[model samples]
Target: MDTRFLGIPELVEVPSVAVVVDVMRAFTVAAWAFAQGAEKIVLAESLDEALALKARHTRWMALKDGPPAPGFDAVNSPGLLRSVDLGGRTVVQKTTAGTVGALAVKDASLVLCAGFVVAEATARLLRRRAGDQVTFVVTGEDGRADEDLACAQYIARRTTESGTDAAAYLRRARESRAAAELAQGVRQGAHPDDVALCLEVDRFPFAMVATLEDPLMVLRPYAVDSLAD
Candidate 1:
């Protein structure tokens, strides 16, 4: 398998398998959403698209840019999903990096939205599909965020070798400037629990995969055991 890492959404292109990384929060939030019983997540390229999807599906949850709206269940924070009952509900998500990168690689043979939470499972999934060329797209903040780059590298390493230290990678990510900003947000009383939650590596056993279902890009989780070679 040929595995390569690329930074930013502009460099993202169709590949045999595209692993979109947004470790600071986006894909972490997505993994939590699935763990909380969310039926499916729809990736929206823009806040306007999320709003339109919300308008069309009254019962679905919409997460747009900025703070949590009154009617929305949560923002882009993974901590917020802890108390949400997402059973049988569809979530529409829009973020600055993760979702944008996901939408950008629409032509990929397989698209996986990844973070520390599903790092091993994502690697396992790629391992099972041997010979597939994988592109790790880091949807970094303004083109380069330490956390996302760390996650992409971690996944790449895991796919190529055994005994990858996911915890160590996460520790480095926690000390990044992007993580420091999140910690600052916590100090400012903004989703204080997110900093810890986002730093938890390999917390979930499922890998979130994206499939274009007509006009919507749907994200669903597949158990790692199911992808065994």
Candidate 2:
């Protein structure tokens, strides 16, 4: 199996198995949403698109930024989403990195939105499908992405090898500039728990994959051992 990592905005050649990662917040929130029993997540290009889709669908919810401001149902913070009961609801999520990176690879044969919360599980599924070349799309664009690159490396090691130091990878990510900004966001009225919540490794035990169905890039979760070999 061959694997390479690239930043989202810099992506040129997309392979069959594309692992799009947004470890700081977006994909982390996606994992949490699935953990909360969200039925499916629709990746939208912008806030307008996300809200429009939500407005059109009676059972759909938009998880965009602004912390539940004007048009959005929920913010992009997992700390706030953890308290909301999303059972049987379809979520429309639009984020600067993760979801955008996901929809960018809409034509890829396989797209997996990943984070540390489901690192091992995502790698396991990738390992099972290692017959093809893989690309890790780090969505923290323009090199402001220590956490995402770290998560990608950890997943690559786990997918090809036997052991991984989840704690070490998390620690590497904690020292990044993004981590500091998120910590500061917590102080400035942002969700207080996310600084620690986003850092937690393997918090969820499933992998989130994006598929084109009914023409929407729908993200759904699969247990680590659920997919047939």
Candidate with best lDDT: 2
lDDT of 2 by residue, 185-207 (tens): 74332487776787887888889
lDDT, candidate 1, 1-229, per-residue tens? 7877786545634677899998867899889888889999999877777888888998898875457665555788777677788888899988888898888887789999999889889989988777888888888765478788888889888887858877777777888887887778742224777878887878999999999999889999989876654
For candidate 1, list the clashing residue pairs, or say none.
none
C-alpha RMSD (angstroms) for model 2: 1.9
lDDT of 2: 0.83
Q: What is the lDDT of residue 180 in candidate 2?
A: 84
